[model samples]
Target: MGYFRCMLRNRVSLYLVLAGGSRGNGDGDEATTPALALGGEGGIVADLISCLEAVLEEKSGELAFPGLRQVFMLNNKDAIVRRAVRSDLAMFLLSGWARAREERMDRYIKSYLDVSWTPVMSRLAAVAAKPATVTVLRRRRDPLATFNSVLENACSAQRCWKVPRPVLRHVLRRTVSEHVMPAYRRCVEEVEQPAAVRTER
Candidate 1:
């Protein structure tokens, strides 16, 4: 138990150190502090995960966890001091939001999620879920396009043709579409940028 605890603590400290952002001063001190304080490794991990997830769900105007999920799993995501490299520097910059739509989202969706979608999320995630998916998010080439597609599907299946899926989906579609989409869209609009930049048109 002691060994596990030490190992965990070290792991947590490592995340903070890496994701902690900023390089040390000439004196070798950190330039910034991690967002959450952890007493134990587990706590650090949990809190950081929760904070990251919370940010995703709310669609706050900041990137939190994105293309870096893989990097995070590999324990390689670190906050950048600046946008020296677009992808790495802005991996956590919040993409499109989903909480600004017009429909009344199913609040029970989350409760249902704890038991239902979690498994499918990981299994068929590439085809069925979206980011902020508690289980597995369906993978798509373009996240924003994925967002639009999911919205269209939700409206169709739900037969409302209005509300977004995943209550946050609705919210983000609304606000994010209005606010962030223009810029983010332009970023993704560059088809030559990457394969995922297929076409939101």
Candidate 2:
């Protein structure tokens, strides 16, 4: 319909405006044309990213629709703008837009994801399904000291024996949530018990 066509055109204009990075002059005239502004490629690229993110957030539904999708795709390709001039700007913008779209889908739509983590999930499930036993040793006189000793020993064993150095390093450094540290702490709760207790004199 005419309405849809108009909507698509407006979306296309928004993309171009963002890509172009036009600003108004104090005299109320459109100053610094796209070509002129694009001379400073960094600013143009940053503006393009900001604009595309805003547009993607605003037009979440229409972007996924057929006609609008085609329009966005073709325009983003920028066949009209030669590779000599646009260089990789079109490609950069398109990739940013795609990421923005995926993030939007993940945030707004339930069970919708653009990435496949099936292998990771399967590995996690396999590890979790394995049977294991845990034992709390009353080695120290104080219960708290015993618990602390068990926790320390468990964490060291998990870090050094069970997990690879590189994976452990990355997980420890990058994992910011409260659960990550507590999950590491929970290692004490899952250790397999030994048949005999050994203590040094």
Candidate 3:
């Protein structure tokens, strides 16, 4: 039991990269957070997958569920421990991965809406500030490039997240449609509009 627990703890430590590193608790000293020290979002996610795979490989034979509907005799403490180890390890990994993904996605969304969108929106505001001729062909912001860059970042993050196949697909589809699509549409409209019409609004 102790050995199993130790293995579980080691696996989790590798998963989070919280062990074997200088760490900060986010208080104030300017030390790097564990996630950041581990090499940012992508690295943490990759480590998570690697650790999970390693644990599964190490415990495969012992982790098989041998019963139909689920039958575990309470009197058998060994059986209970085996069941707990398998189930608990899975739960811990999945919950931790989900949390990491959630935080990463939130950060990406905030960047998209705030920092990434700023340049184009600022240009739009500039146009709106002053009237101009429709055919002047003055230098204008290219939101398409910005939108594409943001989309690429989101896609890369999703690929590295490695949660589960179905969950990853759902997250990517929903995030792209909800966040990137609207910005894309707005960019298209702005680009197609004549200069005078753009600035007028």
Candidate 4:
């Protein structure tokens, strides 16, 4: 397990570094690098996601479901492991390679959200249900702040900002909205507002 983990980490790091270094240098530049060439053909990204799916499958085999374990593995304490799971996954989701494998990428995106952003939104929804916690002022202003924080962390921590604008819009934005907006709307509606105070004339 350790050897496989180490090898995966090194390959991911090397590919990312090579890809970044090659960009904007010249026309047809990135394709010259073997790693980037494989990435262009969706090989590396596909393999990485396949490995993640295998890990999830193995964890699921231990019990009927392992949602918490999936979350823990994706958000692991080790920076390299965490980056490999979260940041690299985000890169793949927003890459041109994903366009050629839409169904696979879509499934991975759903799995990614099931483990990451969905839980945070669930907690927010739970908190919003409590009248004491979400006071009138908080209901009006604080939820947006909290939501912004969540959105920022979701994008920034996963390096979503590093992708091209069109890819980010078409892929990440749409996926986030589908998963988050409905829950956000529910939370907004569920928040218990305080009774209106009447002003004496």
- Per-prediction TM-score to the true structure, in the order listed: 0.18, 0.20, 0.32, 0.38
The stretch of ten residues in a row with the least summed lDDT in candidate 4 is: 192-201
lDDT of 1 by residue, 91-160 (tens): 2222321221111123322332333223323333332333233222124344445545544553354342
Native-vs-model 4 lDDT?
A: 0.52
lDDT of 4 by residue, 1-201 (tens): 453456456767756765764565576544444344455444455565556556755764563322334333332212223344444344443355434434544554567567668756866766565545566557467655666676677666555223333543366557778878887777666554443311121
Overall local distance difference test of candidate 3: 0.44
Candidate 2 structure lDDT: 0.37
Best by lDDT: 4
Candidate numbers, best lDDT first, in rank order: 4, 3, 2, 1
In Å, residue 23's CA in model 4 sits off its true spot by 44
lDDT of each: 0.35, 0.37, 0.44, 0.52
Cα displacement (Å) at residue 180, model 2: 3.3
Give the residue spans of candidate 4 off by over 4 A: 1-101, 136-148, 159-169, 195-201
Which regions of candidate 2 fall more than 4 Å away from where they truly are?
Answer: 1-28, 32-132, 136-179, 190-201
Q: Against the true structure, what is every candidate's RMSD?
A: 19.5, 15.4, 17.0, 13.4
Question: Per-residue lDDT tens digits of candidate 3, residues 82-161?
Answer: 34335434433333544554454455444434543444355544433333432343355443454455456545543533
